[model samples]
Target chain A: MSGLRITTAAEGTTHRVVLTGELDHETAPELERTLARLPQAAGHRLVIDLSGLALCDSSGLTTFIVARERALAAGTGFELTAPPPPVSRMLRVTGLDRVLLARHPQDA
Target chain B: MSVAGHQVEEPEDREASFSALLEDSMEDLYDNAPCGYLSTLLDGEIAKVNATLLTWLGYRREDLVGRRSFADLLSVGGKLYHETHYAPMLRMHGEARELALDLVTADGHRLPVLVTATVKKNQDGDPLLVRITVFDARERRAYERELLRARREAERERERLQRLTSTLQRTLLPAELPEVLGLEIAAHYHAASSDQVGGDFYDVFPLDADRWGFFLGDVCGKGPQAAVLTSLTRYTLRAAAVHDTDPVAVLSTLNSVLRQRHDPGAPRFCTVVFGLLQPDGDDFAVSLASGGHPPPLVIRADGEVDVLTTPGGQLVGALPDAHFVATSARLTPGDVLVLYTDGLTEARRADGLMLGEDEERLPALAAGFAGTGARAVVDSLAEVLTAWADEPSDDTAILALGPRPPEAR
Candidate 1:
């Protein structure tokens, strides 16, 4: 039982993951399993929307890193966008915004 | 006691009739009772056994009455227990109550049972025979087995956790800091949880004849994965410092190494403050660089505290071409420079608010220990981390370095 919830949807050539609620040590594994099951094929893009994410800790950040690595290795494009204020602040603090959020979804 | 008003027949006639009834049922009751009963001679040879006892053991009465002893009916372990404890206790106390044992049946299957034995003696106090009762205990034995299994499982899990924690501690931390001339260094690590391993680490090592390198950092997570990241960060910084002494260059080298040796399984990122120290004139010159780490504090001799901030520094190993900035300061005699992990700044207050990285709380706390050496500053701050709250959410690491005062010299 974890506080985190994940939903996946496909629109056009993009596979989007929507995360809501807190992402901590206890709940990060749920996201990891969901990311692992994605078909990271070429000619597609993976985007995570974090507008409803209330909290994210160090373990959550690690999951994001692993997801990015996996999608890129499969020759698929990856990006994260629409992060809430607190999560955005954390990304800026850890300097991960440059690596993970280099492009906005609207721009794509 | 007789009831006179409720009497229906003459007292003598009623007594005679009741005696006749008891005589008729005595043998039948002994043979068919729910419990098994046996009578054995002084040497444990079976003298007489009830029909119930014969049926329970799947044996015929003639086969056991003269041939086998009471101990022969028991399993091997039960036989040993009967000799060592049951026999001795019965001999001393004239009775042994509720001794658990297993009985062997005709097919050699074990029948779990409880036995109570008593010595029957004559008027002169010499023992004539021993009477024994056996009760089935299969249900109780099954319950005990389940309890034993659960207890063993918990013990094994605890042992594994302790082994992992100790292994991480032994490999990730330095055994001792190198002694440097004219400089005093002190460090303390406070683990928030006893069983879990934290990601914080710090070390001070000599680079060459005239230069020294030191660092304190915190990896992103806790446990074995964090331990691997910490090991890589520490060794890379140490090797990079030997090749180049500039603080910014050393951090950039670490960033590149972390990016190149990418572990997609677990995140490899950390915040660190790496510093290079060298003697200049009567004081030591320090150049410190940050990889998105908390800035260090400079406590002057007169109780004035200043934060040495390296602005726009990115977290190492997370990005390509991560930027780092180095700040310089001079550590005069009696001045202390403090570097710590986020655990201290993020410590929660009683109202559930963080004591954030601001100019007020930490600097004010350090002002009280102005002009004190590195040991005093580190020891007192460590006490605060222990006493301020019940338990901090994260582990804290503190490192303080300063030169000896003029008076001491």
Candidate 2:
């Protein structure tokens, strides 16, 4: 129940990575490894849906920021969508929303 | 039941031989039973003891019978247990089974044994004598001792690890924050586990005669590797501040250092808030930059709390061109500026709800101690974090800076 599950679904050029369950010190590495393997080409768009994310701690947030960094370096479009209230607050408090949520098409 | 095929010729001879065999077997079984058997009178005097009991204790049967009581064969602790627990339980329950005790041997050595005693009563239910059985427990006692020794060794190793972890953790932090003439400074750090070092670190040091620099940050992972990163991050920040005191430039320098030094396979990154303090005539002028770190909160003297939110800042050391934004705040008298790592906000309440889940929780807490100086604010908040329902899951680091109140100055 406390474990994190990561699933990826691709529709055309947009790839959606859905994260579910708690994301803390123990589960952040799994997300990191999964994100590393995903295609971050210039034309590909990466969207991380946090609706199912029950919890996101420091390590989890760090992993997301690194994922964003990787996407940027590769010139791929990156944005986070559907952040749960708790995760949203975390990003807002840390002022990460400015960078990670800049292109939130749905939440915008 | 007689055997049909057996000879009926020697009935008298068979009866004689069977009687002799039964008598011989009965005596031999009693004298050399695997377990020792003894009977003691109501006064605890040994009336009879089997040959096995005498052989185990290296004594003759007559040596223990009638001359020495059963209590006389017990060690000091065994004698106490016999008189207190063993004797009383047998008297009330009529039997005591499998009581472990040490018995003294004839040669002044201790023999561990399991003793089971039953009171043999008369037909009228009157207590007559006690029949006791003894079994050797040498191997069992030795096994128990070995287990105890191994447990103690494990405990010692854990203690040694904790001590080493804490000592290394201390090196990553400043022993004391430099005392700015007009500003009061305080900081606190709480590690989640003592055995493994946490990744949180903070330091406050003087930059110039009238200026000071401070930073608090948390690395992604923990343990020995994290400690090494923490040490590197702390020194790099200090050295960078020396070259450029601007909050943005200082952090930008750190970002480059971390990205270049850390291995590609194991990328290391951290969330950091770096600030510079300078005296501005009765108040301290503070300019801080955030690299995806939680914004600092301000508590006014009037009991109002404000979050100094700086947007558009990315995590330091994670990317090649990470951006950091600087925000300015003036710490007037009775106004405190507090900076903290995510460990504080990520702390969960007893109900599994994180303290940061409610954005107003920390502001509300800070409002309670409005106008308090840096020391009091840091100490109070530290107390709250320490006594939280479950200790903060991660390492938490907090640093508070405030201008001295007029009355105290």
Candidate 3:
């Protein structure tokens, strides 16, 4: 079985989600649902930590984009942290790296 | 009196001993059954467990009998799932059958197992205890993992193949349409399917300082085979146009090359319209030749639409000496000349009517587009195509060329 683990930690107004696993079409929905359930209040910061993520596919990228859009609509800050090399390369190839990548919470 | 007493005593002692032996074996059978068995309190605390289960889990009776709940032995994900879904379902249904779970043994190893559990109730129907039976599922789990890996590998291979097809399709067409002096030009290519490369192609390039060559064509089929023919036809047309600017000569050259490469078992052919444009004052002198392709539509500067007739044409590369027809027209300022593949004409609407089958519909449609710039004409046609109920049934390539007004030039 493909292993996926999601752990959410809340620090004041910032919500950080750490992900570890292969994120393909099968598991992308799990991440989507997790993000969708997060509190969407103005000025709330949502950070996805990808330091432990081993793999990601196009569907996973789409989920991240959707989360970013939702955050923007809700007037919240959103960003991705420490995406693995493969995931970063995919974003670059699709020309979304600069638009979607946020190095720090303040940057977002 | 002594002999009767001895026989009676022996028979009574044997019957008592046989009854005690049967009672001892019944308890042993429950502990040594092939499958693991356990009984948990209503709250999932282990109340009693058999020897078979204790051995499989590598746990001593004292370590688990009243110490740990069943949920504690599961993996983190399994625990979460059990709490959120399994436990609630079991409570509502009173039984959960053949649930697959990963158990963490005392040695920290994972053991996949299939578990069946039922709630045992007292005579008053109040739930009293839960009984569970577990079967080792190592072999089944391994088989399932293999199947999943195979499916994932197949999907990856398919994605790679699609990327390759798209890259090859891009190489078959010009990177950008050539800009001719004093003329406005635009082009669009609509692919009927993304899974395979389409056979439609178009190009506009300078033939000389004073003239330009353009062509739009469709191969007989789709996919890799037709893709090969498309590339070959495009290269041959470009090379022939360089050698001779005559529209008919350019097509005849492609015809001979295709005929030479044709296989008898799987004959290949295409329909093409080759044209040459030369600047003439504030207009362009256009010479076009057709090989079993649709005629070009000229939307005049005064909002009059006319189909340039190039009759007596035959399908290219089908025969050694196929005939082609050449026609000439002058595209004045504000007059757009549109060249397209049969995909446009053959497109079927939701009601099953072909766009090209009704000649009146096409001319009437072009009438609305008369006096529009080349870019507008191409863009509007693309929009019209997108409005179809389904993707165009075939690859469609459209190229429009028109002269610029004197002030713009």
Candidate 4:
């Protein structure tokens, strides 16, 4: 079986999606569908929790960029939370850390 | 005679014993074979399962037979795939072979297995049941994962190298061309491919208060080795220009440096055009030195395009003592001077002719925008380069300089 799973939850005005397993070219479409289904109303906060994510590739990075654009167009707040060391390193190396807002779960 | 008669009398009893032994062995083999076996009804309901299959899945024969479907034993993703893809394929083709999937055990642990299924047909040729054989794939799955990890690591390593190459390539050129008062200057660098760093480089910097040093060059090859030579050449040219405003002297110093640094066995050489520019009244006095490099094109204020001829020049660092020639040109207020690497002339067109090989091609190209300023000329050339049907196979670098109009200045 492909090693990827996603779960969503709601808290007040914020919608949280927790991702697990490897996120690569093979499974990026599944994540894209999940992001597309998210509520895009103004004042909505969407927080993607990545603590359980094991891996990501260029496709995953592109998906995050698209999600950020969607949230901006709808006037919603978007952020990534609790990315593992490898994911954070990838973001830093690609210079995406400055563009994508990331915070710890406790901080969020 | 009595013993022989007794042996003949027991033959019928012995034949019956042998037939019973063969039947017992066949049943045992079916139940205890190495691979698991199962027969499912058309709707995937478990009709018959061998003891081996039941043991592998940690389930009793009663738990599966007539109760569970084959899809029910799969993980969530496996079940989805089976319903969406494999099931439809099986229905159409009447068989599915070597499908890799995971089976969920009674304890919720997944057992990686490879399955091959064939549809059984009755006498009327209608589907009766599906027979599937399952093989344990734990070792194969582990090996595949290792291979995938190695591939991912290699990709990441290549990405890192590209980043380093791009950053290093940037340092080899000036961050921003120095602002020269009364002179409009523009430059462009076109890389053939991003996988390897190209050795084409250009720089426009101030040598002193009145004079400026500018150059465009292409090394023999590309990547780390050529990049090292490019960096060294850029520094050497700038230093040499400071000591002497003579373009020929600057290139001669560079030629000597290249010859001394690299070994004779693996000689490194470059084609370069070094220039020194100084404001002379209403115009700029330009002295360009060639090291087997293409000559610069000058578009006069009156719309006359001319290519300066610098003869008897040899490639830099090619020999112990290489000669260089300095040519002079004057850039009037509306006139522009353009220097380019060989990549431009060598760029191939669809018809197999080079952009600058013919004598009339470059002059005609410049004539089209004869009165344009430095920036406009550079921008136009860049647009032309990008409009080609195919990308240039080599790196190209261009530098254009013109005196600003009196009113604009």
Candidate maximizing DockQ: 2
What CAPRI class is candidate 1?
acceptable
When superposed on Cα atoms, how far off is each prediction in RMSD? Answer: 12.5, 7.5, 26.2, 26.2
Q: Which ten-residue region of model 2 chain B has the weakest summed lDDT? A: B1-10
Where's the lowest-lDDT run of ten residues in candidate 4 chain B? B261-270
lDDT of 4 by residue, B107-168 (tens): 99999999999999999989999999999999999999999999999999999988988898
- TM per prediction: 0.67, 0.81, 0.70, 0.72
Per-residue lDDT of B206-240 in model 1, one digit per residue for the tens? 98897899999999887777777889999999999
Q: Which stretches of candidate 1 lie over 4 Å from their true place?
A: A7-18, A36-54, A71-89, A101-108, B1-135, B138-164, B193-197, B302-304, B347-352, B357-360
Estimate, for each residue in A8-86, the C-alpha lDDT of model 2 and write its tens digit: 9998888899989999878998999999999888888998888998988767877877787778778888888888898
Cα lDDT of model 3 by residue, B219-273, tens digit: 7667898898998999999999999888889889998999896564345677788
Off by over 4 Å in 3: A1-108, B1-35, B50-52
Interface RMSD values for all candidates: 2.6, 3.0, 21.8, 22.2
User: Residues B1-409, candidate 2, lDDT per residue (tens digit)?
Assistant: 3488775657888888888777467777988989888899988899998898888899988787889899999999999999999999998999999999998889999999999999999999999999999999999999989999999999999999999998988888887778778788889888889899889888888888888888988886889988988888899999999999999999999999999875544668888899998888888888999887888998888898888777878777766777888999888999999998877777777888676667788899989989878889999988777666456767889999999976677
lDDT of 3 at B264: 46
Cα lDDT of all candidates, in order? 0.86, 0.86, 0.82, 0.82
TM-score (chain A only) of candidate 4: 0.90
With candidate 2 superimposed using the best TM-score fit, by how many Å does residue B3's alpha carbon deviate from the native?
Answer: 36
Model 2: residue B98 alpha-carbon error in angstroms: 3.4
Model 2 spans with C-alpha error above 4 angstroms: A1-20, A26-49, A59-81, A92-108, B1-35, B47-52, B120-128, B263-265, B386-393, B405-408
Cα miss at B102, model 2 (Å)?
1.3
